[model samples]
Target: MQNFDYMTPTRLIFGKESIVKLPEVMRSLGKRVLLTYGGGSIKKIGLYDRVNELLKDFEIFELPGIQPNPKYDPSVLDGVRMCKENQIDVILAVGGGSVLDCSKAIAAGAKYDGDPWDLITYKVKAQAALPIVDVLTLAATGSEYDCGGVISRTETNDKVGYMDPLLFPVCSILDPVYTFTVSKKQTAAGCADAMNHTIEQYFVADSTLLNDGFCESMLKSLMVNATKCIENPEDYTARAEMMLCCTYGCNGILSLGNSYSGWPCHGIEHALSAYYDITHGEGLAIITPRWMRHILNEKTIDRFVKYGINVFGIDATLPKQEIAEKAIDATYAFFESINIPMHLREVGIDESRIDEMAHHIAVNEGLENAYAPLTEEDIKKILIESL
Candidate 1:
């Protein structure tokens, strides 16, 4: 096993009626609050009213319309401005990963004297950040539990994952009931996102059997519960399981002794979402299977065989290459079965910017050092294959 250090400081208030604790949690943090959200889904689901009722005693400021992929310029800049101007003591991010992600950047940026992009791009390390509390409405990205957020710079078509210890939320409120109204498309995409997170860690070199089994179990649970969620959006059992799976996805716990994967699928999909403004999870779903196929070879075939037999229940006695191929095919079929686009063109991407995206990913994402080491050519080939 590889040597590592792991700690999760974010306090989780889970299950139904967890929102009632919001007042106590926020009061412990501060009075002046910047409430952040995406679009008006919270309002549609009546979460906005509930949160407002809880925060009625505290001074509140609002920053809404934080979009998916969480753009850096307007959302981050506006949020930082709101925090600084209002002298906000804490941030209550009340939407999905994007809202919490933007809130994190805002928390860091509000304390800095320079541009927020400096902290986001790692030009300057954060000394301290405002406290963050989140009510998670989406079960993907695991931003509520992790210290990193992927922020986009739209002008440059750049999506960067920024991690700072200070960015961890002080606490997170997770009520799976909030996700009961999530659309079928988003639920499937969230499943794909969480699965990719585990697979990324599982495929790395120097992983322990314990960690591999943990990942395999997570994948199976996500697949089963995701289908259940799609069939009946309000199924509490499925929603709760899926929510917990996503919560554990990107945090360091699942891969404590595993070697770094370099997260190459995320690297490539970052470019896709940054360029096309597609859903982050859908972009990952489209790229994952193709990347899997491209990276498969004699040396890596054994890992695929294990994944096939363990995760997908493929026949163990099958020939080595066939097992590997079946695993890749199973992955593709799973995504397709969930109604993911399964191709770049199906999501409005074409060959026009394939070279550009490949070069961008190679130059910016550092995927050359990934477990399977994708070069610019390798990235282009995967993009073409995905198309």
Candidate 2:
């Protein structure tokens, strides 16, 4: 096992009726609140009214309409302006990962004088940030439990993953009830996103048996529960378990004491989503099997064999190479079974920008050092295969 240090200070209030405790948790952080969310889904679900009623005693400033992929422009910039102008002491992010992600950047930007992009790109270290509290409505991204987010700059075609210890939410309120109304499309996409998160951590060169077991179990749980969620969105047990798996997905718990795999799929998908504005998880689903095929070789056969046998229950007596190839096929089949568009062309992403995207990912994502190193040509091939 690799030497490591870990700390998770985010207090989790999980289960039914957890949102009722939001008022008490928010008081400890501050009385002045900046409420952030995406489109009016929270309102449609009555969570918007409920949150307002709970925080009625506190001063509230609202920043709504934060989009998927979490734009760095108006959302982050406006959030920072709101925090500064209102003297907001804390942020209450009330939607999915994108809302919390935008809130995280805003929290840090509120305390910085220069452009927030500097802090996001690590050009400047953040000295302080307004605290954050979150109510998770989507079972994806794990932003509530981790101090990192992916922010997109539409103009620049850049989607950067930003992490800072200061951005971890002080508290996260999770209730499976809030997710009952999520569309099947998003539910499946969430499953794909969380599954990829575990796969990224599991495929590393060096890892502990304990961490490997954790990753395998997480992948199975996501697949099982996501299927249930698609069939019956109101299945509490399914939603709850799926929600917990995603919450743990990107929080470092699954990767601790393991060597980094460089998260090359995410590196590749970032460019796809940045250029074409595709759904994040759907892009991952489309690219992962292709990347798997491209990187499979004598060096990686063992890892894939184990993944096939353990996670998918493929017969262990099969030849190692066959098991690996079957495992990759099974992965593609799962995403397709869940009705994820499974192809770049299906998602309206043609080959027009494949070269540009491959070059961008090679230059910006540092995938050359990934577990299975991907060069510009290698990435281009993967992109072509994805199409």
Candidates in order, TM-scores: namely: 0.99, 0.99
Q: How many backbone clashes does candidate 2 have?
A: 0
Candidate 1 lDDT, 1-387, residue by residue in tens = 889877889999999989999999999888999999999899999999999998999999999999999999899999999888899999999999999989999999999999999999899999999999999998888999999999999999999999999999999999999999899999988999999999899898788888889999999999999999999999999999999999999998889988898999999999999999999889999999999999999778889999999999999998989999999999989989999888889899999999999999999989989889999999999999989
- True lDDT of residue 273, candidate 2: 87
Across residues 1-387, which tens digit of lDDT does each residue of candidate 2 receive?
889888999999999999989989988888999999999899999999999999999999999999999999989999999899999999999999999999999999999999999999999999999999999999989998999999999999999999999999999999999999999999999999999999999998998899999999999999999999999999999999999999999999998999999999999999988888889999999999999999999999899999999999999999999999999999999999999998889999898999899999999999999999999999999999999
TM-score of predicted structure 1: 0.99
Locate the minimum summed-lDDT window of 10 residues in model 2: 271-280
- What ranges in model 1 sit over 4 Å off? none
Worst 10 residues of 1 by lDDT: 202-211
